[model samples]
Target: MKIISAGLPRSGSTLVMQMLKILYSDFPLQKVHGYIEPKEGQIRICTYRHPFAAAVSNARIYNDLSDEHLKNSAIYIRKMAKAVDLYTEDGVTLMLRYEDFYLNRKLIVSSLVERYGTKFSDMLVEKALEYSSIERNLERQRVYSDFAHWDSETHIHGGHISEYKGDPTSWRNYVSSSQIQILVSILNPVRLRWGY
Candidate 1:
């Protein structure tokens, strides 16, 4: 099956891509920031994060907390939201949440395999499950320093996850009430659709 993985900038797209690569070693998987037109036999897997968290991460990464930044992030979140809704109707496409993928890798992988008729090894799934922990990724970063820089360092902005308290909602601590209002104003519709 042809697979395309995409998400908003700070979403866990790379991690999902790496995990899928491990699960299906031979399949050619493409990762993109924007939507791709999936061909007849292709399946597009899209990932998304809570808009509040996404907006905060965007600000931190771009180092710009202006209204412009929030507006842009809100727009991207809206676009991905629409994409997920349309893509899922095709039966071949699957929408995965970053939080769910992080907290339940095995179940998500199994569900995707069953729903999409994708082939994967149980043994590889087990190994991937074991390696899904943040500790494992952190260790990988230590051993392969370049892995930290392989994608956007926004995730490990401080060169370490531990520094950010490592919680998805940690963005709450950084984003102000007013700034959150800005995000919510633009994202409320999409956020509600995603059950956020």
Candidate 2:
């Protein structure tokens, strides 16, 4: 089967893709960084995160928290929100939240397997989780610190796992109160929809 892994940038979409790659070793998979119309005969695995945190991460990666950066992040979040709504309404997409994946990977993996109508042994599930664990990814980041270096297998690049505190609200530390207000105001719809 063909699989499309779609999500906003820096929202753990790569992690989801990596896990899926491990679970469905024979399936052809592609990662779409933003919204895309689902294709015929494709399994869509969509992941998303709190808009605030996602914006913060985007800004950090670009080292720009300016108004322009925030505005762009808002735009990306809006597009991702639209994708989420589209996939949810389609009723076939397996929507996974970044927070849930981080907190309970086994549950998320199990859900993915169940949604795909496949069964994986507990050992395989654990292997996928371990392979995609933050520590291993951080090591990859360290080895590939150059911006040009991208790991083909994991689709990870240098500095991909920046300051990941595993707390959704950690975005607050990177931006000012006014910036936070800006994100909240612009992304209120997403927050309400995703329960961020």
* lDDT minimum window of 10 residues, candidate 2: 161-170
lDDT of 1 by residue, 6-123 (tens): 7665667656766766776666778776767768767577777787777666665555667788778777766666666666565666777877766667766876787787767778
Put down candidate 2 lDDT per residue, 76-117, tens digits, no spaces. Answer: 777667777777678778888888877777867778668877
- Note the Cα lDDT for every prediction shown: 0.67, 0.79
TM-score list, all predictions:
0.77, 0.89
Ten consecutive residues with minimal summed lDDT in candidate 1? 153-162
Among these predicted structures, which one has the highest TM-score?
2
> Deviation in angstroms for 152 in model 1?
9.9
Which residue pairs show backbone clashes in model 2? none
- Candidate 2: segments with Cα more than 4 A from true spot: 36-41, 146-148
